[model samples]
Target: MNTATGEIHELWEIREEDDPRRSYAFGGRHGQFSFARIMAMLAKDSGITGDDFRVFFYCGIMTYEEGGATAKEAAEFLGLTPQATRRITKKLAEHKMLLVAEIIGRTIKYRASPHIISALSGRQQSEQAAAFHLPTLPGRSGSATKGRTNDTSRPVPRTHRPAGTDERTAAPETEHTDDVRDPGRPGARRRTHRG
Candidate 1:
């Protein structure tokens, strides 16, 4: 239900009831546990340290708006010194976890990337497919074949070289030696056949 104040109801009370802390609760795991955990993990992975995640969680997850608080406002809401909030906001910005935009005044707002949100919400399955290797897309020159062969028979594109230049001149040749090659300097050159 939309409150008379125009705030849309979200699952679980966001803050203390009837205290104007902007808290509302709808009972369910979706609101209370899952969403909160998503926010917490996003904050952590995005490089928000200290108790900044707490402030970020409250402001970002509860408000339902990417533009929740300026650094000064966050400091006030979190009861932190302004300097502390500034430092935290700076770090968040450095890590690309927060976005700073200028409206009427310079406004600092934070939100998890859409990629993170989609993965967290189960709307995107690719993020969870890390355990399995996906076959390369059709018509693409994938590296190997089903028989565990190198598939060197397949033709691959060669780099274009300028006039009077050969493959060796276009790309540096490397020599494999039983003796250790000093990586600090250039090594000797060796030749191999190309088709």
Candidate 2:
């Protein structure tokens, strides 16, 4: 310690062999994508829903050097119904955003389009997707539970009428005239005023 000067110096500094900018994304690691194109596809009338985006991301991230995942795989990994997952995957594939990497028996695997995302180490490029559990928000995939809860804390309507105001005072009452000239029954009044 320098008691007189009293100054702190860096313990150590990091050195890099390659430029950080040189890396596509995530420090030049895998799972990179073209943001511009993806945003365009997600615009209105794109026919792609948020669910489709979710599945697409999952398949893309899971794309291995030589293989990709099927709709079933995506559904399992994303906690979505297989049918819903299939719908999303098919829609993306039809739009040419995803490529049919291969077909095993009746199962069709998908890869991210090279333009959309580069495989982590996969020989093939493809439509991209990601992993990690997402909250079951209210959207394409409806909530599993009824989600109906009685919230008594909510702001209650103004049940208490203001002082000096009743139905008649609050809202002006319209008076109806009776035809006394007509020789009808004593109580047979056509119109009457409400209290």
Candidate 3:
């Protein structure tokens, strides 16, 4: 299974559950744009980490579905502190990936940038979108078509085994024994022997 090419072949055909409910498939153009292109773009961008990409994607989706999203709302959705969310938003804003849509009193609303929206809409990649080159991460050669493999044939170092465990033997039994004390019973104090 090569992850680089993203080509997958299901060897065994699994029968679907006998539920009468209809399953929805979000794919074709939109799915490719959202999951494939946008995610890769976000991952490659030096300014955005994986977490930052998640927050950004959430913000974009929320904005598209529910008009707009605030930093507090984004923080709540991402389970992050408001300050942390603000920092992510600030970075996105600096990179022109996020746009301030409106400001009502103290609350500031944000939406995905025009470039992002255009790209996600299946339009040609804008100059801003093309600027980000996919990073050459470890174990990956930055070639999307190439399948990832263990390039180095170096043997993995062995570590010391824990006490009472042998590599050749099966794991120790977890069954109850006479020496084991039952803590669930009333007055089940362990007797400390005075040596």
User: How far does residue 33 in candidate 3 sit from its true spot (Å)?
Assistant: 3.1
What does each candidate score in C-alpha RMSD? 17.8, 20.4, 22.4
Question: Across residues 1-195, which tens digit of lDDT does each residue of candidate 1 receive?
Answer: 676778777697466656765444654322223365345444534334556566545544533444345677777878898788877665544433444433344555654333222223453434533422332211124523233333236434464667777635455555454445555667643344455
The sequence of per-residue lDDT tens digits that candidate 3 reaches over residues 1-195 is: 669998887797566688555655664323223345465555554445776777777777766676668889998988999998888776565455667778899887777764555424344445535654322222223432122223335443364567877658777667443344557876464554556
Q: Is candidate 2 or candidate 3 better by TM-score?
A: 2
Off by over 4 Å in 3: 1-24, 27-45, 118-195
> Each model's TM-score?
0.35, 0.46, 0.43
Per-model tally of clashing residue pairs: 7, 16, 0
List the candidate 1 regions with Cα displacement exceeding 4 Å. Answer: 1-48, 62-66, 101-103, 116-195
lDDT of 2 by residue, 1-195 (tens): 466888866675465767433534455336657787677657775556778888877887766444678999989888999999887776666455667889989899997666677744444332123331122222223322223212225434455677776656456454456433335666454654467
Model 3 clash number: 0
After superposition, candidate 2 runs with Cα above 4 Å error = 1-29, 119-195
lDDT of 2: 0.63
